[model samples]
Target chain A: MEEGDRLHLGSATLRSRLIHGTGKFPSAELLAQAIAASEAEMITLAVRRLHLDGDRRSELEGLDLSRYHLLPNTAGARSAEEAIRLAHLARAAGLSDFIKVEVVGHEATLLPDPLATFEATSRLVAEGYTVLPYTSDDVALALRLAEAGAAAVMPGAAPIGSTLGVLNPHNIRLIIQECPVPVIVDAGLGSPSDALRVMEWGAAGVLVNTGIARAKDPVGMARAFAAAVEVGRLAHRAGLAGESGEARHGYGASSPTAGLPVG
Target chain B: MTVGDLEVEAALGPEQLRTRLRASRLYVVTDDLTPLEKLPDLVQAAVAGGADLVQLRRKREPWAELVELARSLQEICRRGGGIFLVNDHVDLALAAQADGVHLGQGDVAVQEARERLGDRPLIGLSTHTPDQALKAQLLPLDYIAAGPVRATPTKPDSVEVGFQQVTAAALVSRVPVVAIGGLDEGASAIEAGADLVAVVRAVCAAPDPRLAASKLRQEAAAATPWRWIRLNGEPRKSPPGETVLELLARLGVEPAGVAVEVDGRIVPRERLAAELVSEGSALEVVHFVGGG
Candidate 1:
């Protein structure tokens, strides 16, 4: 984790390679603990039902935003129009100009609506919104979002909140190869190994919620994720061992097994 | 649901929507209290503060203008994980792709609206007297609002239905009861059997609409239990309409060598996507742990 070589999204350069979601917590106090343990510099908050009177902080309030870049997400929008509107509202509410454009069209699978997401990205980018869209792991789609001026392109490893762990690594790799913007693998990641696997493939970062929040021990899970994300980045930088189809662990020629076995 | 080249996905189906409605408590219907331009911001704030279901009821705005506002408001609600409803216009609600529509006494009949809106969009009827409320119970309404519970300035001309009426509506209605009218100042509506309390100026006209809504909802009982199910023996809150395939996919379970038993019956690998889990459905997934 080179702090200087940070995860860049528009004007914000985040020190943390992993972004955490503020949802599904048993209590606001617990959520706070998980967030602190996660050590995530960027946190994703969905614009959902508010707790009026500000009596209950809804887990978002009281957080030290100075340490975190707020990435408000359009989680419920089923159309590009809906997504764009949510982005603007998020901006007006003083969350941030940076928005994670999520246009979910399928209820059953909760898959990203690729067409809606692309359209929203283009419009929001044109409107000067630092749009980071959550999209399907399609190379062409990633390029399109990048072309549309998205600050970063988020290709989900699996459906949001599913923690499926990189169902399509090939497409994700293709996105990394072609996408001009930084590729953040968002959603469907379940474990530290899953995070490491994507970082190994050169992903800019991973945004996770369910993998941490739903755990029996959320704070511990967050800490584990934080460590995993840090190591994953280091592993990517260090380079992995070379690969081959043949399985040979022992010294073959040194033992003279090839020519002197019969004697 | 295609608009130009873009595909607008349909709203939640009826069966899957039950879980959300059961959990939703506060319903905010936007009125003309705020300037037309500021309505969007107010709705956003109200939702941000905690209004569960937001209804767009722009009285004098043109259909086209209302359509645009509805789109924005609907998106805001959706982002907040709240339901968005359009008041008095089934066509507009359908056009804006809102969660559902709210019909009044003289507006389109509940049956007619249902026929056009089809099976998915929520249909809520606003009633005042006991007969209308009782009649509404006979229809296939997703939910019904019995209101003017204390009579407020928002709807000056409407008659008031005391808390007793709300209690009556709740008694006969099979669906959820939304106590509308002057509910901003009180919590007795919830005590009187109202699952949700709909408001206008109480939330929309507050100095900080978001904070006002939070305060208004302070004493309400918690919404109904979430549809929780066990996955691999651990409790998981299941969203409605979530198929076994999606659930398995989220749990990082590969279809190969993974056995899924939903409530004691094994759903073969081929039938995972077809099987939908309801509230309390027990899912036991046995996927061998390995690294290759």
Candidate 2:
């Protein structure tokens, strides 16, 4: 299919293959520009402080809000109830039903609470919200989230905004290989190469914020990330050689598309 | 911007833009004539009149003054249940922490702006022609304003893009088009495919800006009617003669957990198949969800 073709996941059918982040940009305008440059169909935003329309410090104040799904993140919630409450706040504020469930109990690791995330996803999904939980690279945890009616599973590469890239490719591969829903490599992606690497491994998408927002040239970096994601997705569709079998003395350009390891 | 203390309660962040953006019908653009002190009052009036999206379009104001005004206006828009936007000046927008900014062709490049502002703020553009609108469709703008549908003295030098231009832009553009310039409180603009009708003089010039905005909102509604009833308070469209059971099936809602309420009365789950609903019938499909 062409790049403009619709990407169906659960209820949404988006055009772009990439998912961008709204956090960490210097200004809302810059974030908007990067998202446009990235051509990402969906963007993630944190759910915190109730923004009053005229509040100067509120980041939600000046958005143009036209296209794309606004996936609200439960970034500060320490438990499932707190996450769900914030989810409700997001919805009451006129956000869509889709949410990115991020239940972080530990401040040091900033890692998601597996139990909290699973609990939150179930409730949100039961409320008819499309839940995409951000979790560690645990295959079993990923399976549980998917079973709990998560629209998609988002596994971190390392930590949130760490720019560490994928910490464990093996688990990511397993999650993508087994999960019924789309698998997204979220957080800790530092560069276009990191995004391309994950996509090459058959991830449905990759979410990057710090990588693009903190880059020296955010706009240029945004464009580069967009190209990398496109090329990576295209490469995956075309077929890439995997480490499935023992290599012969010589090598061909690529392996057969059959065992390319798509779920 | 320094990282906000994550624990500190924040204004609803960027994700809420989608719903607010979609629900907004009238976007009131402020003009130079409105006094600095009165701008907040004018915005309040507009919001009272149902101006859900308001923009501060002052180009000649000092940066500090602009930022200061954005603070008060943002609060007013928030209290009024509307969004506040800056016209041009992305830097001032960032400093004031406004919701978004509207940039035209000669303003800051969208990419350059992206370097300064993050993605959460609303970023929109003004397009006068079909080509500009179509090209902008590829950009990361939330909405695009097309036309001076009727030639107005507001910016006499500005080219007038008739209703046909609005139609063309709407047909090709992926984002919402706010038909601007010379738009009166009428269904004409909305009927011509304008997602919103932005007026400056009509509301600003009016002695009662609130009443003027309300009239425009009524016209915009008449032009474009809602297609679906609220299902569980969310918009859902049901086909003619669609039974409650079918909608649940179509929505993929598990019947076991679903409870139906059409209009104001409850319809037992067993009798869901017998109930018929059309376009306007309200639906409250509640279900018991796990977790807190």
Candidate 3:
């Protein structure tokens, strides 16, 4: 696989261009059906301390995990210490290497704390886990996380779940340019066009959950998102039309009427 | 039985009327006392700007002239895909088969109007005091207009009810109460919890009625779901498979002040729904991102 083309997580090489997260489904059965229909290679699962009695299982007890590489997230953690503790608990729950580190500072916006995120990433990386820190679109913060041994730096395009579409494209582009680790544009996505936009910005992969899970038809939206992600990735690799100011005789090469005589 | 029959009745309550007017961008006041000849153009202008509800307030005109003016406004509203409401004129409302009628205290009695118009046409009543509001509830009212909230030039003779009356009416009334009279700015009236806002000269005389109406809608959205995400990480349940955009639409959350995040990543708001939701993943919804 080419350097810019491949999306890798530790040893796993996912074939599907899209990643899926399971939330907002009406029922577990519906969620499973939606996931199966999406044909996504990787899926995210949230892990927290179980409150149930001995050997208690999750609602996803009946789900078949054999096909999916469960990427457990430390979603509820707010501080670096809390995230590190949750990461350890996730490992105890058999989600050791693949940990989605989410350290939120504010309760309302759920904005990832960049400071806590890098701190947790550094600690986790030193502890020998493949850490993926969810941070903001701050290019400097993303670079710092990469240096902290984060396998991937997931920078948000907008606040989590606003679905406003990519609010800052330039920052994401800069992060992809300066960071050595793979850049995954995550969060604030509302539509397929947004997924395509980030991929066109040269993100290694795009991870989505709410946009699909919250749709009126999760399965159909999944298919639409898959197509968008593929088109965006392909267009990125094909080389896109660079944004230029003076309308360069841009249409001359592509338009048949360019060579034809005009009155 | 048809959508129109249900809609005509449904547009009675503030909630129902606001939902119906979701696509309408116009703001017009028939009470302007603009001559019948000039009224059609003004109504058309508001409609052109997307005003879907035009009320014919004929306080200055006598009964005969008011009825004649209503028929003309009704024609304009028809072309505009809007509702023509007669302010304080049950007889003209019945004559026009107007989408509904809005009545003040001295107009026709609520029971008499309902008998004349039947259960189909929407009926809205104006209440200035809490006692009047409580009495309105006993009568069959689709919605209540609480105000004269601020002092405005539209009704120079009308008393200013202040924000307290509006809030009292909202708290006491069983039906949806729209704050009327002088709702010039968004912060005060909306923060007071008025369901649908009604402005006369403020909206009608504005340079751009569409933008004026949009500003009110923005205000209403801001005041609602005030705390978008309440407390720690408890996911505000969005219906499964809705794009954050679609979810917002379903929840009646305005397009602004809401964001979508998936898999610990901020999916550009555009791509959130373009990608599908994986089963059993966490989805967080936040609203009212801006302002004090």
Which predicted model would earn the best TM-score?
1
Q: Model 1: chain B TM-score vs. truth?
A: 0.71
Model 1, C-alpha of A217: deviation from truth (Å): 1.0
Off by over 4 Å in 1: A49-57, A243-263, B1-292
lDDT of candidate 3 over A1-263, digit per residue (tens): 23455578787677666777775565666667767877887777775433211243344544576577666677888889878866665554443477789989888998888889989999999998988888999999999999888888988878888887888888988998899998888787789999998888778887888888788998788888888888888888877666335443365344675558766
lDDT of 3 by residue, B1-292 (tens): 1354333222244455545643332234654655667777777776665455678776776777777777777776765567678888787888876767998898889989988888767788888998898688778766788888988777789889898887777545545567777676555654564555677775566776556655655655555311112111432222234354554454454433233445454445556457554433454443210000
lDDT of 1 by residue, B37-95 (tens): 88888888888888889998877788888898888888777767778999999989889
True contacts kept of each: 0.00, 0.00, 0.00
Q: Alpha-carbon error at B202 in model 2, in Å?
A: 54
User: Candidates' TM-scores?
Assistant: 0.47, 0.45, 0.45
lDDT of all predictions, in order shown? 0.77, 0.77, 0.69
Error of 3 at B85 (Å): 71
lDDT of 2 by residue, A1-263 (tens): 36564567666787676787777677766766777788777777764422111232434334544466777777789999888866765554334787889999679989999999999999999998989999999999999999999988999998988899888988998999999989988989998999898888788888888899899877789899888887788878777745445443456656576776678
For every candidate, how close is chain A to the native chain A in TM-score? 0.89, 0.88, 0.89
- Native-vs-model 3 lDDT? 0.69
